[model samples]
Target: MLYQSFREYAQGAAKIGIGLGVISILARWVTGITIFASPEALVKYGIFGGIGYALMGAIALMAFGWLGKRVRKEFGDGLTIGDFFQFKLHRVGYWMMIAILLITSIEGLFTQGMAAGVLVNILFGIPISIGMLCFFLFCVVYVGFGGIVLIQRLAFVQVICMFAAAILIPLYFFIAKGVENVYQGIRLYHPYLLVLNNHEGLFFMCTGLFIGFGQVFVDQATWQRLYMLEGKKIVPTFLLSGLIWATVPLAFSSLIMVVIFTGSFNNIYSLLFDLIRKIDTIFLLVLFVLCSFGAVTSAFGAGLHSMISLIAGNVYPLLKPDANERQKMRMGYMLAIAIGVLSIVLTFFFTPTLLELLFFFGIIYAALIVPLLFIVFSKGKVDNFIPLCALIGLVAGYTSRYKLGNLDAVWVSMMVSSLLVIVHWGSKFIKKQLGNH
Candidate 1:
């Protein structure tokens, strides 16, 4: 079921039709971070902030639909984002992109692994180490052994669990406690949540748009799915997936309101635990656990699979052009297992708050967005300076963070990259005009 042949194993079966395409994207994007991050936004920046969080993701995914169309029109036969970079970039630029993508993808896995540890610890009272090990092992087995087909099948089931929880959990809370009580409770205890005109919230929304655009635009997993889908289905699948995916963060944010209405908690996980206590039904509890676990695992699996694809498709081939299909498949499996182990180790040692982690990496996403966009839209191969632009932006962004703060650093990063690209293109345009004269 996983592989039709070695070729299929290397580059999926290309059998993810429209319906499966939507669900698979949904499963990948509707992540554990969304479950917690939406509520955290609401609590920190008010209602608008929460709405902004959902809007950023929805808009990003929808925007990718347009990019997907371009991708198919330009290079429909590509297997991975690495393939696109290989074609669009010089050797140095391609390697830079590959390295950046690998770092970010590893970070993605680490985040999901952390979320998995938290979920298992919360739900089953298991130690985080044991929980993380189990989660990593599960992903390694299925994704490493079964490839894209297995991941796609599991994605469908995971998405079903997510939708069930997103719809039912919030609805049940509203019915049981009543919206009026929830609203009144927020008014009495956390009135900031009700405020509509939060300037900070607006700032966050704008900056978040930059971060979101950068993230989805460069995500190898999203690009992999684009290749997996039928050519005609690409835009509609992403557009519909974005629309459906928005509801998840919206619903989960509302659920957070229900928890805070009762009382404030020490932290996000505590709030989650309190919400679990409020749900009197055992079935709902089980559903919530399944939903949370599924989200984490699905996301981790997607990241792992994409990383494997990038290595096998781009890195390994360059290293050993003589390697056969079976050899490539074996390398992918080994990489998956190695990544799983590394992710577990990292998750155990590092424990930053979710938003902190996001903002820290926000610098990279901000820096990458402009160059990646220029690469995609440019008619011909881009110069080596494009990747160098990203590198400089990253340096400037991080340097500015201590003085200006995280959000400002993101703006600086984006501005620096955009400025560099614009100047280079303009200079070239002027040179061409002078030559014509």
Candidate 2:
């Protein structure tokens, strides 16, 4: 039974063990965007680029395992990432972080909402608006009402759909088309894809590592999962999830390769359509639809739920410290619907390509990574200026975007934040020495 009690609704039945943790995390990470983006990375940066994308994600999640262990040790009993931020940061710092986190969570929801619309339009010839409306409505009903227990249960089914598509689709193409023919086709058409010494591919891989790290590190949904796991199981669960997650992008990218090796395509979406047409089997078509929809809905639902938790747990309590559990629960459910509707409206307006959207936010992720890591690893309360470091980085990063290009802007943002932190701390150390003298 899902959420049989109030306690179950609030915290789930019990701390998730390793197996469910891995599967649930997988469901969260194997997003609809990943299905498209993995292939896009392959087309843009070559075969190594695809592999790099997979590696970046795996490493980020594995690294989070280390952070998760530390966070649990520091704050063993917490409901959300906001709880951790409230403990670690001063009032102003905590507010700033909460603001940024809320925005990022909304952006995540919007992205998934957009993907759902796109997938439905492609698969069923429905209007994008109608597709998104139905998608968000379903997510709101299930996740908003059912809570974490229901989410975990649904996650198992979603992951099964994703795994089936990821494995069987690529495997079928390889066997039916013949591996040698595919290889020969690629060699003849896109020689760059095969080149080992691809400079652009290498650059993308390096930058992607930074983006991936920051994305996972600051993600509320991920942090929520970290809190949901048993103390001892945390590290192993994340590490195993990372390892398993790497294969998804790799497999999805290979499936794209099956499309590429056959003929020329205008864009990533076109290639996806071409692949679908080639598959030409109703069973595989149904599988792909389930996989895509599941990925998008699961991701959107996770983000929406986590955002509600942050608002209900952190924000509402600040306004009404004496609020009861029933009040908080009511606030969470109401906020979920509001956020779901907001995501649909935002998705309608924001029509950028997926990569464009990611790179635009890449600046933020790059800027946040160093400051966040410093906060996580610091032994004592960090200076409030540490959080300001993200603002400074964002300003500098965006200012340089036109001149330096998107990827370089990300590099600059990270460098600026890292420099500020070093200089700020170094000056403090010197002042201490001078005062002692």
lDDT of 1: 0.86
The alpha-carbon deviation from the true structure for residue 289 of candidate 1, after best TM-score superposition, in angstroms, is 1.1
lDDT (C-alpha) at residue 427 in model 1:
95
The list of candidate 1 runs beyond 4 A from truth reads: 1-6
lDDT of 2 by residue, 332-391 (tens): 778767766787787666677676677778888888998898788887677789889987
Where is the poorest 10-residue window by lDDT in model 2? 1-10
CA RMSD of each candidate after superposition: 1.5, 1.9
Give me the runs in candidate 2 sitting further than 4 Å from their true place: 1-10, 435-437
- Residue 262 of model 2: what lDDT? 66
33-112: candidate 1 lDDT, tens digit per residue: 88877788888889887888998889999999999889879998788899999989999999999888987987798778
Residue-level lDDT for 371 in candidate 1: 92
Evaluated at residue 186, the lDDT of candidate 2 is 94
* TM-scores, one per candidate: 0.96, 0.95
